[model samples]
Target: MSELHDEVLRLSGVGKTYNPGTPLAQNVLQDIDLRLARGELCALIGPSGSGKSTLLNLIGLLDSPSAGELYLQGRPTRALDDAARTRLRNRAIGFVFQFHHLIPAFSVLDNVLMPLMIRHGKPDAEDRARALELLAAVGLADFAAKKANQISGGQQQRVAIARALVTRPALLLADEPTGNLDTRTAESVFALFRRFNREFGCAVLVVTHDPRLAAQCARTVELVDGRIVRDAANTAAK
Candidate 1:
């Protein structure tokens, strides 16, 4: 695949094990081969201890695989140094976790621009404009000047979503992003993801335990005991 429309993430014979080479070594994932293409919205569903979180970390470049290879945007990443890995992650991947992780003291706009500030020390006009645009897209344009602690739970999560998209990453990874919201709020958050995936043309891989939420994704990848038991299209999910 080429740059604009290439595989966002590719795992070949990927495996992860904790305490490797020790008597207490435990393999968590094995031979996990998968490819997520550009603009695809996929759900990763699995039970507790199924290696779902572990796999997400590896894919997000927060962790490395014990075996095989993980490629992001056609580039192999296992051998990259800490600095290189961090750079790559910031440039290519966006993450939204269960908790918003917003800085309570910072205004919503500043929070959304945090990544850019980290990279450039301060954001330029274009950067600020993009952040505002994302906040608008998430339905939080008016809340930009307010502190994160001042917003509702759902609103805070929407700010997190805007923050994640500020970098215009090629891939977006979300782990239980809507887990803390009410059913209606959860659905709205999920809808924002879908809308951003389409508008930004970014591939999305979201981990979710809620079957109802998972059913909304275009594809489902079920993991059990660290293995991909099923990877199939869910046409009706849309």
Candidate 2:
């Protein structure tokens, strides 16, 4: 089967530790087994210090697990070298954080095209067209020429989401993406995630503190003290 149709991510007994092999070592996650399928939209919810961030880091390939294995598209990542990991991350993942890290001086269009430019210098015509399409999808079609700072906070965040999708990554990770927006704006932003997930078949795993947001996802995974306490599905039905 093609990778596009396979599980986007899998964690088996994944665990994290700080100051390993020492008395001060702290275990944040342990025996975490989870899988996210293609086109699935799930919410990751946990309290402060529950290791949500740590778990995300491991999934995103930004950090390594202290134990267990993390697989992306069926590729084991524990032994991958830095260059290999970076390449995989660039090719397979898109990230949106709570803060819209748009470049203030760059035009919104340029900001949205930033990822492709980083991977391959200069944007081709097709790349520009793709960015425009995303901007329009995010309701920022006309703001492309303006600087990122000139737009409303919600608008800027929309641009960030567009930027994240420009690469058409197989998996999209959002960490508290709506935490800074007003309720209305937050809903709009989340709606974009749902829209893109349906349109592109990219799996979405978002970490949010808002119960309202968590409940909206098809599946909700609750983490407590670095372990998955509950992994519930069919949320919309319940």
Give the best candidate by TM-score.
1
| Candidate 1 weakest ten by summed lDDT | 1-10
Q: Estimate each model's TM-score.
A: 0.97, 0.96
Q: Rate the local accuracy (lDDT) of all candidates.
A: 0.94, 0.92
117 in model 1: Cα distance from truth in Å?
0.9
Tell me how far the alpha carbon of residue 72 in candidate 2 is from the true structure, in angstroms, after superposition.
0.6
Clashing pairs in 2: none
Q: Per-residue lDDT tens digits of candidate 1, residues 1-238? A: 3353477899999999899989999999999999999988999999999999999999999999999999999999999999999999999999999999999999999999999997788899999999999999889999999999999999999999999999999999999999999999999999999998888889999999999888889899999999999999887876
Write one digit per residue (lDDT tens) for candidate 2, span 141-238: 99999999999999988999999999999899999999999999999899899889889999999999998888888899999988999999844722
Model 2, stretches more than 4 Å misplaced? 1-5
In terms of lDDT, model 2 sits at 0.92
Residue 35, candidate 2: Cα error in Å is 0.3
User: What lDDT score is found at residue 21 in candidate 1?
Assistant: 87
